[model samples]
Target: MKNEPVRSEAVGISEEILRKWEAKGVSRRDFIKFCTTMTATLALPLTFAPKIAAALEDKRLPVIWVEYQSCSGDSEAFLRANQPTAAEIILDIISLEYAEVVMAAAGHQAEKSKWDAMEKYKGKYLLIVEGSIPTGEGGVYCTVGGESAVESAKKLIKNAAATITVGTCASYGGLPAAAPNPTTAVGVRDLVPGATIVNLPGCPVNADNLTATLVHFLTFGKLPAVDAIGRPKFAYGKRIHDNCERRAHFDAGQYAESFDDAGHRQGHCLYKLGCKGPEAFHNCPTIRYNEGLSWPVMAGHGCIGCASPGFWDTMSPFYRRLPQVPGFGVEATADKIGLGLVGATAAAFAVHGVASAFRKGDAMESDKVKVEE
Candidate 1:
């Protein structure tokens, strides 16, 4: 077994940092509330709020974010995060030692900074890989500092405490591995099979999940409990359909057959249009994107199941039902439909039990919360 991190608050927030943030219009109260929100997101006891506060204040943990075969969408999502805001993320959370897209330094300087940080933080820093690794042609498809993506990841991840695969690309090869998969793109787990990796998959992952996972790591000094695919169970435990806002409509058999139809305008369930929520596990419905404003389904689009396995291929034919899933099959009996709905309803109730642990909480307290436009 690996040795656990010895917890301490020695590196917590300093007065100077607080003063700097205060000048930026963030009051101490707002800061505490944000910490409380992070605590909520982690489903940690309220008592742990102060602990999270202390950890963020400490800011001793270093992170190295690398992009491989990707569109940099995940990095953009991280920067656009609204719940706590990206500025707050950079100033208050983990020390981002190196990132290819964001760092000011480039060329040899950027490469030096990364290697230096890795050497300095060895076996302690968190490694975040934001894209898939292309193994084709000696991994010549994607290179940084003259090193292939596979080579770079292998070098860095080996010395890190834990790894986080931030987007569908990094998690499961995403679009890069779709169809013929010319690049032979594969996820971080496949490339570094021995490393402990937490996959947060989506076209561009929800930033809140990234924040919560980081908090969990800081709080426990270890990785959070994960599903079979190495997704944190706290975040990926429930099927999106189970907690969808249109679930009542689905239960009542009010489905929209087309985007232009009256049912869609009426906010009917998107099952008929091939919503993949039933088979997908993610908190998009509850977490929503852009500071809890709205999600794809809420916007009248069927879930493409971006967070599910092999989504690019398996969840395709975007506007049609998947061939025939087990419970929601074409030949399913009436009893099966009733049982499925009943189970979905029951799962809906249980979702809160887990959701409350880490959800950003405004919704937990009030239904009056409006989506940010």
Candidate 2:
């Protein structure tokens, strides 16, 4: 009789993790699929799937999640992660040493847990911050356990293996740091100069990105490559417009003039209605949200450019169209340029199509001659 493979257990994965996976209805095949999905999400080749799986099974990173001045929407999103589920990530994949939002401890006990984790993990744990740090009035605006936000962050970040700032609030001061900033809110990068911070900026960052970042670090022992502004290139390499569903409409010079217009009903481009897809750099259109269901534009709403720096000020007023398309002359409007380019683009495609057909015919004739010979 042939022996069946028992891979997960034989590979040194803890029985506890396997139990948790079983309880969560995640089979070994499901786990492998998850690893493959993560490999692809990180823009890594499928061959890296086994490496990612090994890392996840072997390394349980110690994580300390902190929050300061802003809504807890990012934490909420983190909790609702469906790919691995928050329970599996926190309990099985990572040793979440301290998280004020989810940990059972509270008050001084909570503070003690944080301090203890900091001391125990010391220079080894990952620090994940959710909101911006308030710098006004001696950082009195946001305090945790009698320590100001700045003071706590400074101490915590000093010895961290890496710091990940989730949400636009934590990445670029977000809404709190917008115009006439009262609390003088600033992001982790602003608070800690000379520190390498991985930024995942979104109104409420997609949990999958955060998970992928963690997995990348675990798999490779270093953070993924970042763009000029420190966002992972794999996730923010291209503008949303590059892969937007309405790109054809935009290229064809079709756009929605208002919220309830015929163009919108027919799924036309939202650029004229103030879509910032052309300027915003993110994987929202590809990775999507709510379990790969739909994104804002897909839901009939224009992109508000939440992923870009200081989008609240730069991309507003949200409903007003940009004067000119990016990478184009200032005098020419987007629709005008689109109209002019549409004709040229169509002509070029027609020419290319004809040439391709001719090439195919020539190839067929050559193949027939070779077969006869």
Candidate 3:
């Protein structure tokens, strides 16, 4: 990503938008603070924070947000971002041309606005898909503007600069593609092959991560470095287990066997209760949710591995630790192995102490005789 600031003229944010911010009583300083916070969240140095501000202030990228088979939870998460505030996000971050839930236009008018923005921005616009694309029965399961999810995505993504699949539904087909999926739902990667795609896979994706991603793109004119699955490294680099508040309990072989147990109430590890944290990677622990307040584990719930692929099928049934163990003779649960290893280590140390004492006694006795002679 480029370290230098983008020229104001290069960005598309309008003076009218700034006026709207002013009218809403949101100060310029508050907006800059939001940008700086987001830049830091992206793991970029504070120096790049101003660059982010410039990008957001001057070059507002047009976004066409489309929803398919979803509950709009992802949008709700985005709206609840406390730093930027939902109004600022709508009016300042990006030129949100059309969204079904947020836009005042309905039916044909709303669809027209989306197409108008698409034609105007064409290769420059960003396409954000919020839900899954159903392809069963000729894509008849889900429709917007009288077009199937598959058909709309295929057409709109053709000239888009990048496509972001928000939420697990759009990113990995989520719950819709779970057991006996009648809709034959598929993610954006499958629907729009070879397209520049970023998958923010969560039951409801983190709002801060989404904003940080857009800021990174604005500053660098390209998407941030991503992992194999197109997840931004800064956000999904480490497993939740690595930063869990109850990690000490896990290392000490202490775990909550059930939800209401004393161990759980005492804030012990929930691994035995089926936390997918060991196998899941996301910034949920660090960045957290709802203004850095808390995450699932902090709230006394184990991670369901919502951010990882095939989470619905692979991570469940939730409330039990992962079962598969590699590099072992027999299948062993983490708790069983942890306790066994601890016991074995203690036994070995005890045996070594006994042997060392005997050797020391023999050497001391010989030295005493030499002194006497």
Candidate 4:
């Protein structure tokens, strides 16, 4: 995407040289566009705007991506990120050296190229891993070229500036690590315990999450602060149901019973229809998908919460809400159990009011007789 204005960071060149070659200074329009969007995504203060602009002007960072036992769907989702701008956006800003899926190199040549890049820019490139590492059967389950997946990971991670685990596969072991775990699938953290890992926990995470993370790393010169699961707080912090468009309908008790129901046409809440946005975390609603085309909830569907740890085991059925969540024992479905209590309390109050009226009537008669006496 470079056009003499934005130079690639693959050459191991210093910032001073790149700064001079930078023909196109970040435009006022483009800089503000990114600042505004990033402010909303990260909820940063207005004061950080100047810092973000400075970060953009800084030399682009280099990245190397690896795939393990995954479907490559997360990369596909990132490929759809059509934001910031054609020249100064997230992907455009970073120098991507090696990614098996999109890399133009092939066969033995491809493997050689990746190694060369790693060695050339050791400790300077971000390592992004998609999919899970298989530990079963001597790691024979997944072999690239002649090396095992785990072995390759060990080699690359030692010198990586930072690591980003993309998708549920790389973050939580995905379906491959499910019960029985025939493949003995493990996330990047499981294999490389020493590295600071960032987990984007989704079956196919939103592209904006990926971009935001890269931006954060670029701006801060280190990975952003993450939660217990190693996910950056900005993207994976809030629940989808919080900012959902149909959240109003949810509060009002309006629901869509089924796909064929009238509520579907009326655009009622899909909470009852198995929308898992309430518990699921991510910026899907706000970022949407496919350049603001549509997200799962907007299309009249529910989230499966593929991002949650042990999601394959705990968040099963994908459609039904959790009956009992992790660390929450005896938890009932919020709607059914809560409404039931409220309804019973209202009924009991109504019966007590009737009894009180009868008692008051008899007391009034007794008082009149006493006065006559």
TM-scores of all candidate predictions against the true structure: 0.81, 0.82, 0.80, 0.77
Residue pairs in clash, model 4: 201-307
lDDT measured at residue 346 in model 4 versus the true structure, 0 to 100: 29
**1-373: candidate 2 lDDT, tens digit per residue:** 0122446543435556555555656666567557777987899887777677768774689999999987999999999998878988887789999887888999999999899999999989999999999999999999999999999999999989999999999998999998888999999998898786899999999899999999999999888888767788888776777789998888677888888989999999997787878667788998898779999999989998887777577667777654334343223332343324323322433455423433434324532211100
Better of 1 and 4 by TM-score: 1
Candidate 1 clash pair list = 11-58, 12-57, 12-58, 13-57, 40-358, 41-358, 42-358, 43-357, 43-358, 293-372
Tell me the spans in candidate 4 whose CA falls farther than 4 Å from its real position. 1-28, 85-92, 324-373
What tens digits encode model 4's per-residue C-alpha lDDT throughout 101-127?
777899999999889989999999999
Residue 231, model 1: Cα distance from true site in angstroms: 0.3
| lDDT per residue (tens digit) for residues 1-373 in model 1 | 0122322233233445445546656765556556666766666666776566656655657999999999999999999987678777776677899988788999999999999999999999999999889999999999998999989999999999999999999998999998799999999999988688899998899999998898888877888887777787667777777789998887676878788999999999887687877767778887788878899999999898787667577666567643223333223222224224323432443454323422444333342211111
Model 1, residue 121: distance off in Å is: 0.9
Off by over 4 Å in 1: 1-25, 323-373
Q: Compute the lDDT for candidate 2.
A: 0.79
Give the alpha carbon lDDT tens digit for every residue of 1-373 in model 3.
1233433233323445444445656654455456567766898776665566557655678999999999999989888888778777777668898888788899898889988998999999988889888899999999887888888899888978998889988988889987688899888998877889888889899998998888888888888887767788788776677778898887676888889999999999887777767667788988898888999999999999887666476566676444321222213332333324323332433454423433434324532211100
- lDDT value for model 1: 0.76
Largest TM-score belongs to which candidate? Answer: 2
Off by over 4 Å in 3: 1-24, 27-29, 324-373
lDDT ranking, high to low: 2, 1, 3, 4
